[model samples]
Structures are given as structure tokens and as C-alpha cells.
Target: MTQGRSIRLFLVDGAPNGLLTAEIMNWTGHVLTGPRSKLSELVQRPECGRTGIYFLVGTDPDGDLRPLVYIGESDDVATRLKQHNRPEEKGGKDFWEKVCLVTRKDQNLTKAHVKFLESLLIQNAGAMGRCKLSNGTAHEYIGLPESDRADMAFFMEQIRTVLPVLGLDFLRGIGRPSSNQQPEPFTPTQPETYPLAGAENPRLKMEVKKHNIVAFAQELDGEFVVLEGSLARGEWIDLKHNYRHLYKQLCDEGVLVDDGNGFKTFVRDYGFTSPSPAAAVVAGRAANGRFDWKIEATGQSYADWQDQQVSAAAAQSEEMEPT
Candidate 1:
């Protein structure tokens, strides 16, 4: 089981949407994030003058599944940020709408340290495929001492931990499930047990025989994950719905690629907020996920299986209540 973490978030302007700071317990790294409209306020903060890596986040004009990001490092982040905030005609970036700065509380990071961090961040972001990076080329920096490299690696892990809590999840990679695994059935007696723990969840399948589509998915940590190697329709057939856009985005990101047949294959496991979108992508049209996804072993509809769990939990609760 993963251990719990405590994170502290401070809203600078006393507004949820305004400038905010985040820090994890026992971590030396600090994070400050805010919208582009608050750029002046963010740069004025003392942390901006320290050496650090920063991220520029914005929507992708190409309608990709992921947000667009530009990673960079600077000895004086304020100066670099000011330059980026300039008019586009002045060689400034206009796409970014939010900024997140990662710096150290001890203020001991050097130029080489941040450069090395920037390089790794870019590489990892590309590997995660959760965002479209705007940077042209990633320059490797190997000047850091071995000890310093170890420290930076730990610092990078802290960054990864804190960013997701701050609503930045592009750094998180898709979790791969073990092959041919079947999740244990949810036991109603264990009310406190997490339903989506480990690889115990059932493998669900969505088959559209007419279109030759067959997709496999599982519920993990509350997200519906379409597994790698699942087959989907090559083209979106429903133009009336917005899920077609998501389908197109997945294709553009290479999450779905042509199999040389009439179908598209999942290059990697991808998680959706829920099963409906996953079903929509697989079927090439709008679909009701609860009815569409079925337990591969029992052929039970997802809705029926989920309803059974809920009913069992309720019965368990009633039995536990005072007679």
C-alpha cells in the first residue's frame, strides 16, 4: 500500500483561482502557481529571483488530448518570465495561460542543477505523453556532481508528487496492468477496503462485432483505464457528439495508431475520467458505458456488476446496524 502524504497549500490572494503555493512535508522544494493574469504578482515574489525550473501551461490550439507545456530553467526566473510575458511580435510566447515555478526553500541550487532538471523534466514529460511540449529541443546537462545528481533526482520526485495535487497531472504516466489478471470480487464485509486496490479488479470487455472492435478496460483508482493493445475503430463515426474530438486527439497523440487493418490499436494504456468516453472511443460513436462494458469472465454488464456491489454494501451496513 502506498503511504499517505501531507501537502500544504496557501492561497496568496485568498482566492482559489488566484496565486497559490504548495509544499510537501519533509521536502525542501516549494511550488508557486498562478494564472498568467497574475504574472506581475508572481514575479514579484522572492522565490522568483531564486534559481529554479518553471512550466508554462496552456491549451493546445490543435485540440490535442493534453495541454501544451514549455519547460525551462533560469537563475533568475523573474527576468525570464518577464521576457516571456512580452508581446508575441517581440518574440514572446502567447499560448501559455498559467505559470508554475518550482524552487528550493534553501536557495542552494546552481545553474547546472536547474539545467539538468529542465532537461530531465522535458524528457520525462515527452515520455509521459500527457502534454504537448512547445520546446523545440531538450539540451542535456551533465555537469552536476554525482551527489548533486542524486539530490536533484529526489527533488524531481517531490516535484512530481506535489504537481498532481496542484491539478497538474501531465507528469503522471499511465499505469500498466499485469497480463491476464482478474481482480478479486469486492467483499461487502470489508467495508473499509478500497474497491480499486491493486490489480484485483475485473477485466471488462467492449465488443462491437459488426465493426470488428474489441477493447479491454479495468477500473483502477477510480479511473477507467483502456488497456494497451485494445482494438478500436479507425475513424470516428459520430459527428454530433464531442467525444469525436477526444477520439481525434488520442489519434493525434499517437495513443491510438493504425494496425494496418481497418482498426486502431492502443499504443499504451490510457485512463479516462469514466467508462463512457472510453466506450465512445472504442465504438467510434456515442455509447452508454455501463451497458457496453461487460465482465470478460461472467459476461455481466458493468452496470449490473456495480449495482451488485452497491447492494451488497448496503446490506452489510444494515446488518452492522444496532438491532
Candidate 2:
């Protein structure tokens, strides 16, 4: 009943000489690191790799101790345990921080003992999936895997089912949900425009088509922006990652007229199909986004607004920075 009391069990098997180890210890006591021997000599070699399970238990401050199980299917059980025992990676986690390495002291573990241990852990681990008992409790089998894929699925399902039975509450850990928080009002930033100035040139001719492919560039308060082409579903894509590359490529092709504000704008005459769905999208967004965007208000198109931004940015940069 002491807070320090806890039990840890391990099912060790690999190639030939496998063993089952279990121990009881205090929460603050030294935890076993890992098995001393290699995995090939531990569990008998199966067709592919090897598999085993580890179980640890410890009392909380209130002296309630329940076993926590970690299952594994691996080529090297000992090596994996060493990784978990280290304090840097998984070792830092609470469940792994106090691992009790287990080994059978009374008798060398046989195949029966390993199977029995696996069944015992599974029965206590969580809800039933499958199992078989052999030799009147000397051996047990749950058809669990010796691979990570099957073992992880089996154990996670068990833990999910058992944690609730242990009376552990996680949702209530933080403050309870509240309904009184007031919604914050949103204020729009500057406007959005298409075909920012220097984005498309007079020489660039676009054909009129049924599909609306409104391409535009704009300048606003000393900013340059450009967008053109059709949207899949009236949606816009953020190309920030490729902005620099796209801009440099465009400039190299003579699509960009100026570069300032740290990032360069597209510099070439990238053509787009005509008719322009962008006009409609920009018009719709104009209701929400910044910019005096309106069919009647600004008497200008989204493409024009974009051009204005670029022109303004170029003009301001020229005025401020001496050549």
C-alpha cells in the first residue's frame, strides 16, 4: 500500500535462450536499464524478426499502482530497450522514466513462460481480442504479433480501454469549457488587387475567352502585387515559399520591372487565358478584403489596384533610396 511500491515485468525472447523477468520496486528507486544479453540469444528466431512486451507498475502519491504495458516486435529487443531507458528521448517521458527491467531469477525462461507472460499482460492490458492458455497456466497465447505494426495496434487499443477503468481523467485536467468568452471583432488590413503595376505590360496581349482568367498586378501605399490565372474552385493559393524563386524567374524573363521591399516581384510577362474569373473572385473578396475595391466605388478593376501598388512602391523606393 506504500506509494513507493510497484511491479515491473518483462517478456524477453529472441533466438535461443529467452527468459522472463519480473521485479517490484519503489517509484524513486533505481530502474533497470535493459537486458544484458543480445536479442538473438534471448528469443528464438521466428521467420522474420522477434517480438516481446514490457510491463511497469508504480504507485502515485496516493499509493495506487496499476501496471502499464509496452509491447514491441523488433529485430533487437535489447537495443530498443536501451534507447527507451536513455533520459534524452523516450526516456524523458513519464511512462518510460521509471522502467523496471524484469528477468526470471528462479528458472531460465522457456517458450511456455514467454507465452504465459504475454497472455497475462494482454488479459490485464485491456479488452479481449484473442488468447490461448497452455499447460494449466504455464503458457498462454493471444496471437499477438512479433512486429511493431500488430503489437502497437493491440496495445494502444488495450491502453485506451483500460485507462478509463483506472479512473484517470484527462479532459478535466485543464479549466472546464467556458461559454462566456466574447468574440473579438476583426479589422481588415490594406486592400487586395490584381495585376500589380509592372506585373503585365501593354505588349502582353490576352485573348478574350469564355473562361474568366482575370490577371492583374497592383500597387498600394508602396507595395507591389500580382496574380493571374484560373482558380480550381474560386480559391486562392498561397505561394509564399516559391515567391522568391518565382519572382527571380519572372525578373530574369523581363516580367518584373522593379525589386524592393526585401523580396522581388515577378518580372516577366507570364501569360494567362482570358475572360478572367479573377474579376469575379476579386469582386466577391472586395466585400471583405481591404482596398476600395468596388465596381462603382474605385471605378477600377482588381487588376488595376494591383498595378497601383507596384507603381506606388517603385515610386516611393526611387524617392527614398538614392541610386
Candidate 3:
């Protein structure tokens, strides 16, 4: 079972969108995040002078849904951030609109420690494919002592845990079964099938007979994940629809690859904010995902299944309450 964690968040300026700091109980790591416009104020904070890693995040200028991110580490993050905030003519990056800094409250992080963190973060972010990384080449750092390496690994895990609470999920990988639900062993022979094992959230299938596309998806951790090896329409037919651009972006990113016929295959599991976009991508047109995605076991639509779950939960809650 996963243990519960206590996290404290403080809004520095007492404004929800203003500068903020986050810390976890019994953890030395600290996170400070704010918009680009607050660079002057953010740099003035004492933590900015410490050795740490920082992330610059913003939307892709090309209008892709995935944000553009650049990760860097510095002995003096304040100075480095100042350089990054300069005019583009001075080799500064103008694409990023928000900055998140990760430092330690104890101020024990060293140059070598942050370098290792930066490299590992870059590698994980690249592997996750949740954002478009602005980093050109990830530097290798192998000089840390064995014990320090272990400490840094724990630090990285804390960063991963804290980041999502701050609305930064680029490092969050594809969804997995919840703690109470254990995944069934995967069979290579049945590449297209995902065993449900009577789980509450069953695997859903979306089929477009006209396009000969078959896709599999599941809801995990509140995100709809289109499993790898699922098939989607080779060409997006709804040109004027907003989701067409998303389909094109996925194709460009190689998440969807041509299968040599009239369909594209998902190279890896990809998470979407909701099922509508997932359905739209697989069907090659705008689709009502709640109606289109059906439970493989009972042929119930996602909407119906979701409704049943909600009703059951409400009834259970009422039964548990005092008269």
C-alpha cells in the first residue's frame, strides 16, 4: 500500500497565481514556482542562490498541447535564471512563461549533485514524452559518491511527487493500475488484449469499422491512456476540428506511426486528459468518447459505466451515513 504524505504549500504573495513554495513533511527539498513576470521577485529569494535544478515551462509556439520544457542546474540559480530572462538577442529563451525551482532547505546540495539531478531529470522527461524538451544534449555526471547517488535518487522521487501537485506533470509517466488493483500478467501472444481481472475500471475498446481502426484504452489515475499497439486511423479526416492538430502533433512526435495500410499504430502508451480526445484521435474524426468507447466485457458504453459507478458510490455513501 502507498503511504500518505503531508505537503505544505505557501503562496508567497497571498495570491493563488503568484509566487508559491511547497515543502513535504520530513523532506528537506523545497520547491518555488512562479510566472515569468515574477522573475525579479523570484530571484531575490534566498533559495535562488543555492545549488539546485530549475525547470522552464511553457506552451509550444507551434500550438501543440504538450508544453515545451527546459531543465538546467546551477550553483547560483538566481544568476542563471536572470540570464534566461534576458532578451532573446542575448541568447535568452523567450518560449517559457513559468519557472519552477527545486532547492533544499538545508542548503547542502552541491554542484555535482545538481548536475546529476539535471541529467537524470532530462533523461526521465525525454523517456516520458509528455512534453517537448528544449534541452539540446543531456550532460553525463557520474562523479557522485555511491551514498550520495542513493540520496539523490530519493531526492528525485520527492521532486516527482511534489511537481504534480504544482500542476507540472511532464515527468509523470503513463498511468498504471492503482494500489488496490494488481495488473494481470501480460501475454505477448495476445498483444492487443489487456486483462481486466474484474477490476473496477475495465479496459475499453473503440472500433471504427469504416476505417478498420481498433484502439484500446483504460482510465487510470484520472487520465485516459491509449495503450501501445492500438490502431488509429492513418489520416485524420476532420480537418477543421481542433483535435486534428493534436492528431498531427502525435504523428509528428512518432507516437502514432504509419502501419503501411490505412491505420496508424501507437508506438507507446499515451495519456490524454480525457476520453474525448483519445476517441477523436483513434476514429480520425470528432467523437463522443463516453458513447464510442465500450467495455469489452459487457459492451456497455463508457458513459453508462461511469454513471453506474457514480450511482453505486452515492448509494454506498448514503448507507454509511447516520439517519
| TM-score top scorer | 3
lDDT of 2 by residue, 10-42 (tens): 445432223433344422111122222432343
Model 2 is weakest, by summed lDDT over 10 consecutive residues, at 169-178
Rank order by TM-score, top first? 3, 1, 2
Order candidates by lDDT, high to low: 3, 1, 2
Q: 163, model 2: CA deviation in Å?
A: 17
After superposition on all CA atoms, what RMSD does each candidate show versus the true structure? Answer: 6.4, 24.1, 4.2
Model 1, 138: alpha-carbon shift in Å?
1.2
* lDDT, model 2: 0.32
Estimated TM-score for each candidate: 0.89, 0.20, 0.92
lDDT by residue (tens digit), candidate 3, 212-275: 7889999866689888899998889898899998999899999999998868999888889999
Candidate 1 residues 209-246, lDDT tens each?
Answer: 99778999988755798988999998999999999989
How badly does each model clash, as a count of residue pairs? 2, 47, 0
Candidate 2 stretches greater than 4 Å from native: 1-53, 56-68, 71-77, 85-95, 127-323
Best by lDDT: 3
Clashing pairs in 1: 183-200, 183-201
